[model samples]
Target: MSARLARARRLGALLLLAGTVQATPVHASADQPEFTVTGAPADRRDVITWGASADRMSNAVADRGYRLVVHTSVAGRDLRVRLSNAFGDRPVTFDSVYAGIQKAGAELVHGSNRPLTFDGARSVTVPAGGAVLTDPLPGRIPAATDLVVSIHSPDAAGPATGHWMAMQTSYATQGDHTAEEGADQWTEVLGSWFYLDAVTVRPLAGTGAVVALGDSITDGWQSSSDLNRRWPDYLARRLHAADADVQGVANEGISGNKILADGGGQSALKRLQRDVLSQSGVRTVFFFEGVNDIKAHTGVTAQDLIAGYRQVVERVHAAGKCVVGATVGPYKGWSEWDAAGEQVRQEVNAFIRDSGEFDAVTDLDHILRSPYDPERMLPALDSGDHLHPNDKGMQAMADAVDLNSLDCDSRSRTG
Candidate 1:
């Protein structure tokens, strides 16, 4: 997809007069130098309030429509939706796309559903390993609201891409139901999010964002399903309450992801650019990975993980953003837990705390560890699996984070 199309082009005055199309909102890409949308005012810049990392997908049905439901983290207007074909083997064409507020179940709020366009056209084609951002809708999306993005692809197949573990209930149906506000025909229930990857909004100046990069725990494994109880979700709520400047939160965690190697998804090093740096208004990246690599018994040492962490920190610093390194949480009861892996985890956590390499440090290990036995996770917090945390534990991890470290104030001091 061309930038003019992938990144929604400005709606000219003539088009506005003709009422042929609405304005699409464009966000800064990794290659793009600014966070501000082209031709947009300086004060109202787009920031990523919600995002899900795109991963390899199966079951790409032809002539199918999906109504993906996602929760936003910040209050903002002129909302934009991003659709990805990142892992596709060929081009995919979307003839219709719509954005609206969820009323109940699969139904959308009356009169809130509106069609989205790509480059002043109703349809757009996304090439292999590319994405498209729809034009902005002229309205406000409140914080902690469920936003529905409906999309229809007439011929979509072959190695599609999306976040497989949405932890929310989305809907699917046959044919082009993108513009429908009623839930009558949307009968399929989907556990994973398809096609749609991100949602950005124009907010007041100085409002920033933080992206949490991690594994299954951060992916909301044991946290209650469909409740938005992920640690990052809790942190987003905190950001909105105490800090006005840094209010956006993007959870980029993929289940089974490793920091130094690729398995469930691209390794942290390989995906940093797209998942973290490319996101607009990202003042910091809260690094919370490496559990998979260490617990998998893959011959991954503490030094190997540290090298990867250093590379990530250098790249984030180069992009002029903060990296908040987190200590790996305890996983004593899990089958993969072993003395050698425990030793490696301790060494890595020590470096994360005392090395002074990261811009900020969030001692998650200190927070989640048991008082009686420091090497194991606290039983009250453990979700019975001992590796992942329950709702209470997830909230505890979010509370452990110093929200001040997530803003640019720390980055300013470090830089």
Candidate 2:
């Protein structure tokens, strides 16, 4: 055979072999193990918990609608629904909770939703400071389903705890937007409510979770709920859009969570395992906590706060996972307003901006703080509380973090 002909035949043979390999699915990929927990597989225990003062009340609208949108890739069979009232003073009574496939930026239809049951019947009550796992009989989630969970309150809940992350401003199908509407029960109509607790769709085995840990700012206080304005939520949206290789975010920012001692619900140190390290598929953590520690207590200097930060970093690192530190933003005339505290905050901020201990640094403080008044927060950014940034401000903070920087994938041991 001619030399050219022989080489051509060899190349063709190699191409054929590559095609066969690509066509054949590996057994390991086909039969990967699904996540199994202490609860029943048929039951949906999707609500992840954190927070303080379940008793603290905020007036939400009556008969309002709340919806949770999640984009999931399901490789497992037999899917179900899960809901949460993880932080409640009294029993969190669900007037109605339903789940079903949904369209992008739309309300769930009544006929499409399946009624969820706890134990074996309609309506389950989750006690204060505890959660209930519900049966999956209500819904059958298809593979890679975008599940929408719509729920409403049976009674008034003061201070309806929420981590709002609506990308565009979420609208109330009816009525003016106010804190009072948050207390109102959500009807079965196609209206959007605020706050998304948890959404678990089957993930391909080995899909890692990116846990965004922070304070009320991270908790998304004023970001119009349903609009998906919260930075973390925006990050999730961005990740989904980019078709990134990681699972979506598991946001554990309680309105008042601090890094030092217990404040908002449980301090960052206290809730690390439950919120970040303990999460299934969690391989990376983005830490934006510690403002509360500075704002809540005056005795601790910025140096003290930095020490607390080091401790947090040490704990996170010891777990063999990656930790990204976000600098504390400018807060003026807010809680614990003191020149000394501000000075301390600046010192701590400098450390965060320059810290080499962290696997990555997200300069959120520099992104949102006022340029004219370096100490004072930007008017547009500050929520009326001054300490917490408004929705737009939160978006800027989220924008500041370079998602590309969190390239390391390190899983931590579950304690």
Candidate 3:
């Protein structure tokens, strides 16, 4: 073969390996004088360093304080917190809010606790179906740091919004103890995060984030508690160590979440804007969902699920961002498993693998499925249940993601 033809073949192979089609490049005129636009650099914007999916609260706790522990994904200054009343039926008042570094258990690092305000006011009342963001706290928070967020609701009632399976242990108190940095008053332990949904930080220019949108598996259902072993957590660590511009990760997974309907939480279609697009500095959306919809046997065909996926992709792309779709993993031994559901799962995975509708694809089904059965999860990776993955399986899923796929230029998509 000619040298030119060989080079073309090699390029085609590389693009195939990357799972993306090549776009034609635009060239500038060589005769034009290159005048540089010089001025003060633009201010850096806030990027989400940590987040949890919000779901309807099981019960309401009145006049209570919570000291939540969350792990940061990227380091930066001017930290901020977002509190949600998304599922509340009435107005909820959060009179006190504080942020600090966790030393151990409910104890905070000495002198690290700081008060937070909303629009210069110490207290804010979030209306039903609304949310509030605190003014930036002036300080640098390092990546992978254990940050503590304390909140006290004076007269909170009605439905509460929170993530039930946090996979981390946070503390709670009977009365207003958000001001205290000690663990003495925080005697009650909880496995969920309340009110607070996202934490943002102002990072340097070029820093970006990815949001993982999915169901119980993505929510770290079977993963160890307090270990930060969720697949997204692992992906965050990988991004921090790599040369990729996407260094932050926001996990938007709620247990029993569906792609088309509202059950455990608002459907992925309904919450896409508030949960994914509204996040700061999110360059790409990692879409890994649909198992619940399939297993629920809701008469949803592969076409229905594909339509939902297309809608999500279109919305994200319209926002000038890329999406990486993950194939649904196997769950043949799970209680809800049925041959008809499995058939739908197979059809959906086939589309995700071959359809090029997504900017990129991650074959999670190939990674998590048992080599022997091909329809069941690997026993070693399964956390006793056939559906959710354990820590090892979570790490495997994170490893399957190509780090380079997350770094998409927003201008390229828009232009």
Quick one: best lDDT, which candidate? Answer: 3
Lowest-sum lDDT 10-residue window in model 2: 17-26
The candidate that wins on TM-score is: 1
lDDT of 1 at 163: 94
What is the RMSD of candidate 1? 7.8
Candidate ranking under TM-score, highest first, comes to 1, 3, 2
In Å, residue 118's CA in model 1 sits off its true spot by 0.9
List model 1 lDDT by residue over 194-279, tens digit each. Answer: 98877888765556678899988888988998899999999999988874567889999999998877898888877777667666
**TM-scores, in order shown?**
0.89, 0.64, 0.88
Q: Report every candidate's CA lDDT.
A: 0.81, 0.54, 0.83
Q: Candidate 2: lDDT of 99?
A: 62
Model 2: lDDT of residue 117: 57
Candidate 3 lDDT by residue in tens digits, 135-227: 789999999999999999989988898988888999999898888889999999999999988888876545678999999888989888889
RMSD of each: 7.8, 11.6, 10.3
For residue 256, give model 3's deviation from the true position in Å.
0.7
Residues 1-415, candidate 2: write the lDDT tens digits.
Answer: 2542443343332222111011112122111211111123321112121111121235555555565555443223234444434344455565566565565444443356666555566665554443343454433444334566565655636455443332222333333212221323323333222433444433333333467887767767777755546667667665555444443466667776777776566566655653454333444678887777776654877777888788777776766567888888778877677777777788888898787978889887777778898777788888777777777787777667676665344433223
